[model samples]
Target: MAVNQMKNRMQALGLLDRSFKAASDDDLGDALERLDDEHREALESFVDEVSVDGVRAGVRTGRIDGGMEAIAAIVTDAALADTIEQLGDHAESPSSEQLREVLPGVVERHRLGVTRIMLAGTVVGEAPASAIIRDLLKNDETLALPPAPEVEIAPLLDTSKRSSDEQAELRAKRKAAKAAKKDAERARRAQSAAARGR
Candidate 1:
């Protein structure tokens, strides 16, 4: 496959290694941790969809039993799970064993990077590229790192900035307003009492 074509395929499979490398693992982990149950399920489903067992089945037999058997078989085969986990989305969809067989060199070339990045992301507790990309699409900031120190901060005199005197003056005004309200209430009560006496 051409470079552009391979990149496009990799992206469709959801392994953007460059973005994964640039992202902080802590940020990604926090984001994954914060996922609602539904999104967590979706992430798991997505992972299964791209798993090596899923892919190897898709590639070898084109999901002849509609993938259920493949999924079941994967549970028992550590080797297949490891391979699928390494292959990620590259193992899924239209690219079958025949396709790879037909264009072994091209298919291998595209799959190399996809497998490498997926393997790298699966190191221990780090967030996988697939999960991070899914959360990122929903505009979740959990995968985002804190702002860099070099980033330009707002000026110290922004709208919320207030001097000590200004705060004191505001407090005094509030106090005066409270006093005036109390005086008004006293006057009204005195008027009511006087009218009652008459």
Candidate 2:
């Protein structure tokens, strides 16, 4: 039905069914007469494949639960839902540029997730938490994402924001480490001088 609606064609191929007690003589005759030899064989093959006893032969099958629920979750996210709707519009199906503009907002705002970079210009910043994203792009593979946005390539990635106190603390820690190292070096020089005098 989905394919039919998309392609504007009736699914005539779905008319055949073989599950029944038994067909009457008239019904059997009509079934044989309605379909051509090839179609009859095709229908027979389909029926045989679907038959529980026949289907289990020469084939392995496994059951999956929550498959549809997983699909539903992806479709339900605000950004994902919007993208699907945009794609469905057909007339104004967002172009590459639109997808680019849309994705950043979706990631930063709606998705509340950091992306590759936050540009303050000249100085490139943080990278993704996932090494997989970095490696994939590093190898110069065309990502299977929707399209390339008008993005600045120089900004490597976006990191979580740091407040003033956090920055100050980091600087203080670095300065303390440097002073400690310098004092250790001075002590080592004084000990050498004392040993040489002795």
Clashes of each: 1, 4
Alpha carbon lDDT of each predicted model: 0.38, 0.32
User: For candidate 2, lDDT tens digit of each residue in 135-177?
Assistant: 3223322322222235666865343577888889988999999
Candidate 1 — which pairs collide?
52-84
Q: List the residue pairs that clash in candidate 2.
A: 116-157, 116-158, 117-157, 126-157
The TM-score of candidate 2 is: 0.20
Cα lDDT of model 1 overall? Answer: 0.38
Shift of residue 48 alpha carbon in model 2, Å: 37
Angstrom error at residue 23, model 2? 54
Candidate 1, residues 74-174: lDDT per residue as tens digits? 22233234455554566442133422232234224323323233332332112334343333322333223222235577767563477889989988999
Highest TM-score model number: 1
